[model samples]
Target: MPILGLKAPGPSTPAHFSLEPLIRPNILALQPYRCARDDYSAGVLLDANENAIGPALPSASAKKVKVNGHSDSNGTSGASASAEDIALETLSLLPPGTDLNRYPSPTHDELKRRIAHLRGVPDENWVFLGVGSDEVIDMLFRVLCVPGKDRVLTTPPTYGMYKVTANVNDVGVLEVPLIAEGGKFQLDEDAMDEAFTANPDLKIVFICSPGNPTGTVIPLPAIRRVLENPKFKGVVLVDEAYIDFAPSNSSAAQLINEYANVCVTQTLSKSFGLAAIRLGYLLAPPPLIQILTNTKAPYNISVPTASIAASAVSDAGMAVMAEAVSTLNANRDYLLETLPTIPSIGDILGGNDANFVLVQVLDGPKGKVCNNRAVQVYKTMAETRGVVVRYRGGEIGCEGCLRITVGTRTECEEVIKQLKDLLA
Candidate 1:
């Protein structure tokens, strides 16, 4: 059965020796609801038995009166920059209850339109809103993978959700380890090719640019090579969750129109400072987007989440945040330069484009080991220094490494000072 150019295994089709079974027996047997496209049309008054009158709750800040004051130069102003104040100031011009009561356009059309404008993609090719990019990851698995039959290929020491989501869906995971020579991590294209060749049933390939934990962006040629392979014609999910931090152009968003099999997932959690709001999006072919939207539950996005995300994507705020990205990059560079000077630290993995730096601990003079010892040190740093950094030893290829998120100059200095004392 072919849907969206790719072939799904037909009822009588025999499983090829190279190709594992396409769908899990349960998923294959299950029937999905097929609602008419017109069911979601704009002019609907009564369709799916929704309350035509809408919710009874008033606007969030409607009761509170606005207090006038000068806008603070710094982003954080105590009582003066409260949620009410921020909402009143930023959205003051818009009419009351414009976005407050009505269930946010279920598919996030306006938000997607703005994102398309920003990313330079045709709105038709994008799937705009998700709870987070993590939802996109899970949705791809749910829509494409045949749980227990279809598998996903991922490079180790990459994003954890690729495996976690696979496991949740009971899908097989084929691990292709990254090259870890000299403590610098690089994608092993040959290993990836071998994995795809060995498991022709692999439905998804998750590539994280400026990867989490390591922060090394996969080289462009490596990605191109994977896409070029005939055996790897399945969806290539290039998770650009941290791409804004990197200097390299995003492969998924940039090349979406050119490749039908590619999907790029991004989150406002990192750069947009809206992690708490949980707005993530996927840019993919419209056919794939249709499948995802069909599978997803109604009212996936809350009223508050939509409002905050829309506000964050405002032009003025995005420009200000671009400078914040530069600041974080500067802090990352500072840590990269200053960290190796500490006697206890060994090689640093990634400080390339992302905000975090991964540092390996060196052995002591007595030949003491320090890889898996990161958790203890992580706890010490948190307890004594009042600082927190991710310890990544338990992750696939991250033995003996701590992932530290770069903050303001003062914050970075405080962390460095604490590390220096610990090393001493």
Candidate 2:
């Protein structure tokens, strides 16, 4: 069957994919709540029912402006800054005239522009900001899948939150397990094609690159096959939360210009080391972005969050992130080499593209992979040894696997030492 909302494929251009048929009818017609900020956030603003007296918080002192661990020298030190004080400082540092009194921009275009530039997308129109990647995931489900009627496809042993969010939105999940032979957790293309033929109404396919627990990258060729699949008609949601830790040119963001159906979600939580900020975004065509903006809460991106995020995506912030990622990649290399040398450790799984390693724990040096031993090691380390790692022994083909994040050199050595002792 011809795909919904897709134009006939041309010689040079990809089949133009429209979101009209996929988005809920009501959402397409939605006249978003026009918050006060949508009009004017300027002088004499007695709007949005905000506290006209200004932010109800403690006043700021000489506080340091910290963006992803690098603190600005404001000459203040020796005391922990209170949350309110930090919030005030965040407002104080904005380009000059902005304040915390008004609602945040219904559309934070500047931040979106920075992110678009960072991700190599065309412009701000292609970007959609969310509370976090979680919100982005939820929003996709909300717009595309009809609750209690429609379904989305997920590749197993991937990010668990995809399923959780699907369930929350009352959407059914159709899971296709990744090909796990030889510890290569890649997409089973034939199986996925079969799934598409079987479930033609599937609205989204969730692909996690540098996937959680697995630390593997689903190569672009595999993704291109899915995108080029003529039988399937819905959006392909690529979750690249760990992309920065992966090799260069590993992002699906590059496909945005070519395919209208592609949507890539990323976050500050991963490589930027800004989890507390809870900032995440989606890169897609402007039509879909407009629909989401209409559906989302006005001022979803707050002043403090936007301020911090702006600093984070700046040139200086990029430098800091690059240095940090370099250290983590080196640490991951250390784990990949050292973990296998341990007697009880079995095959190192996946591509090890992310900042983690998936190593199997065994019954003995020569014994087979054992989930019981893996569980024991995971628990004992977390409880007794003060070393913690995820026991993913039950996931798909990941028998006896433990997912260990690549920490500092010292941390990597400590976990290796503890695992060696416990498995001994």
Candidate 3:
């Protein structure tokens, strides 16, 4: 029951927030599982029951690629081999360390270092990698909230995962809907404050900036108000899964040093285009980081995932990611300017900070939004037609709304064309 026992913040960070009360007691007392790699990774590397003679598959990383013109061991000319033959040969070979016999590194310091520099954190200590941000989200609930007794705050029409995860964990979720009338989709600070006051026992507050359905950002000042609220002693989770698409300075990672109670979850799934790799991380004060680290599985991140993520956040990868974000932002802008031209298009909500847009589909005559028609159009687009857009008819202020991802210029144009043809 001892709270406020953890160290506040690193010397320079303005955040002097304590973590004892915020973190679950059992978690704070937990002794982390020590994986084999924790002690050493270099030298003989024979500690973890690894194969001595190498993996079962032919080592592709060490082998030279025999040219297509060359003959195979079967004496068939490589040049004469069909495309399927080439694919089979490649499959027969395997990349070095791709074998499943060995365990992955438990502590991915290098990957953390890469993320630290990219996120402008003090060092790797500020970061913790998850299988995906989903894992991190779950870890937060497990580590911070009591199963049936605790609660967390979430903005409605936001990411569904927060509510889903809360429900799975049997935690109560307080709904504070965002301001939806304007395109802002910003946090209703007063309402949230009232909720916080009403629910002081809440353990976490999930805010998806550049929100999922909304595709709009919650401003820093609004976030700061929550973080600075002395009455709300729990963690303020800023899910910046779309931060890269927003303006550079709009990230809450900058506030980590300033607010110890704040935790930011970021992922390579979106802007980095590495969703398949499933690498997401959290940046927070060391105390909370240690809590999650202790609670997480020893080798939650696989070696292949780490390798792919390392390459993705590398200098070259960052350049390519920036370019992709640039293109997507342009496409998003194009959708914003073009979606309204269609007679069926009503309000294109949100600040358009993320890679997607939320468009309201209006019916004829009085221009009223019709959820039934929106659902029909969504089904038609996805099932019958080749095009696909999400129907967010059930969410708050999203009735008759379609969540459209900003695709390539041609693809966007095709969507517009199809909507025009279909709506006509």
TM-score on alpha carbons, each prediction: 0.82, 0.90, 0.88
Candidates arranged by TM-score, highest first: 2, 3, 1
After superposition of all CA atoms, the RMSD between model 2 and the true structure is 4.3
Q: Clashing residue pairs in candidate 1, if any?
A: 210-217, 371-400
Better of 1 and 3 by TM-score: 3
Q: Rate the local accuracy (lDDT) of all candidates.
A: 0.70, 0.83, 0.82
Candidate 2 residues 1-424, lDDT tens each? Answer: 2223222231222464556788898777786557666567668777667777655555432222333235554533234866655555555556554556777777788999999999998888789999999999999999898899999999988989999999999999999999999988899899999999999889999999988777889889889889888778898999999999998999999988778778899999989988877999999876677778778887788887898899989999999999999999999988888888889899999888888888898889978999999998899999999998899999998999999988889999999899778777
Stretches of candidate 1 above 4 Å error?
1-64, 67-95, 248-250, 365-369
Query: What is the Å distance of residue 85 in model 3 from its true position?
Result: 12
Give the per-residue lDDT digits (tens) of candidate 1, residues 1-424.
3233222221211112111133333433343433333356467645555566654433234422322233342344346587655554444433345544344456667778888777767773466478899988887888788767778898888888898999999988888877877655677888888887788767888888878877888777777667667777577788888888887464457666666666788899998877866889888756566556656776788766766676677798688679889888889889989988877777787546677888876554233437645677788999987999888877765677888888899999988898878767
lDDT of 2 at 10: 15
Per-residue CA lDDT of candidate 3, range 122-169, in tens?
888789899899999999999988899999999888999998999999
Those runs of model 2 whose alpha carbons end farther than 4 Å from true positions after fitting are 1-16, 59-98
- Looking at candidate 1, what is the lDDT of residue 400? 77
lDDT of 3 at 254: 92
